[model samples]
Target: MPATLNQLGLPAVIVVGAIFIVWFVAGNELMRRRGRSLAIWSKRALDPLGGRQAIQWITLHSFRLEIEGLKPPFTSGNMTGLVESWDVPITWLINRLNGRRDMVLVQLALRQQPIRGIELFRPRSLLAGDARQLAVQEGWTTEPFEEFQLAAMPGATPQRLATELLAAIGPRRADLLRLALRRRGLHLTLALNIPNRQAVQPAELTGLLQGVAAVALRYATPAEATD
Candidate 1:
C-alpha cells in the first residue's frame, strides 16, 4: 500500500504541473487579445482628434498610445495616453486586494503656457501629496470644491476654473479623478470601470478632449495660441 501511494503521488504532481502550464498559456493569450482590442478601440475613439501614429504594449494588459499631429482645437504639441487594464487573473486579484481599479491617463503638452499652475483632484487620490507639495512650493492656496480639492496660485480664480472644468467634463465628472494645469501642459486621469469586454466609446473620449481644449483656449495667451 505504501509503494502504491508513492507511485500515485508522482502522477498527481505531473497532472498538476500540466494544468498550471495550460492555464498560464491560456491566460496570457486572453490578456493579449484584450489589450489589442483596447488599442483598437482607443484609436477609433480618438480618430476625430488625431491619428494614432504608434502603440506599444508594455504588458499583456497595459499599452501606450501616441497621437501625433493633433488637429485644430487642440493646441499643437504632444498628446500621450496610456491605458492600464487588469485582465490577467493574478493581476486582477492583486489589484482588487489593493483597492485599485483600471485607469486611463492622458497628458497633453502644449506648445504655449496658456494658464497659471493649478491642480484639482479628489481627496485621498494617489497624487494628493504631489498637489500639496506643489501648492507649498508655489505658494498656492488650497481650497475644497465639492468632492475635489483645488490648489492654485493667488488670483488664479480656483473657483471659476473648477466650475468651468467640471462643467466641461459634464456628468462624467465622477470618473475624473485628477485634472491639473501645469506650467506647460495638462494632465488628466480618469477612473475606468468598464465591465465585460467592452471598450470606451468615441464620443466619451471626444468629450474629454474637447473639455481640455476648451480650458486651454479660454486661458490662451492670444498670440501664443495661434495654430
Candidate 2:
C-alpha cells in the first residue's frame, strides 16, 4: 500500500506543477498588458491560495515606463496624469462574476473650471432628463428628450451647449458613451462593459476621453476658479 501511494504522488505532483505554472504565467501577462512603469510601491503579501503574492503600484505619472527605475524630477519633468492599478486576482475575478466594471478615471487639469450648474448628457438607455447631481436623488426631475437627454441643475438646460454635446457625441459613437460635466472636470463613462480587463483597449479609451475633453473645453469658465 505504501509503495502504491508513493507511485501515485509522483504523477499527481507533475500535473499540479503544470497547472500552477500556467496560472502564474497567465496572471503575469494580464497584469503587464498596459506596460506599467516601475512601481513606487511594491508589497509582498499572500495570494488567494495563501501563497506569496508580489505586486507593485506605480503612482506618479511624471516618468514613462520605458525608462528603468525612478528618474529625478529634472529628467522626468512635468507629470501628465496619475494612474492606480489593482492587481488583486480575487477582486478582479469577483468583479467579472458580479458584473461590476471599473475603467480608468482621468482628471486632467483644466485651464478654467466649470460653473455651479452641471449638465448631464446620457445615452438613450438611461432616463434622458435634468437633475442636479449634488441634490438628493429623490428631489431630482427628468424631462426626457431627444437622442441624448440633457439634464441640468440650478436652471434650465442650456440648449446651445446641449446642441454642442449632441454634435460632440455625433452619430457614430453616441450610443457607446455618457458624459457628465462638473465645475472642475468632465466625467466620461463607457456604456459597454466587458468581463475581462485584458479586453479593454487603453489607447481607444484615452482617445475617446481626449475628444470629449476637447469638446468640453469650449464651455470652460473664462476665469480661473477660486478654491
Judging by TM-score against the true structure, name the best candidate: 1
Q: State model 1's lDDT.
A: 0.63
lDDT string, candidate 1, 1-227, tens digits: 99999999999999988877787787667666666666666666567776445776776667777666776555433323333333355765665554344455566655455656677776674456877887788778888878889888766466787788778777667566677776653433333333332445756867776777677567755644446
Clash count for each candidate, listed in order shown: 0, 1
* Candidate 1, pairs of clashing residues: none
What TM-score fits each model? 0.69, 0.39
- lDDT, candidate 2, residue 38? 17
For candidate 2, what is the lDDT? 0.39
> How many residue pairs of model 2 clash at the backbone?
1
- What is the lDDT, from 0 to 100, of the residue 70 in candidate 1? 73
Can you tell me which runs of candidate 2 are displaced by over 4 Å?
1-21, 35-56, 59-94, 97-102, 116-178, 185-210, 223-227
TM-score of 1: 0.69
What is residue 51's positional error in candidate 2, in angstroms?
A: 43
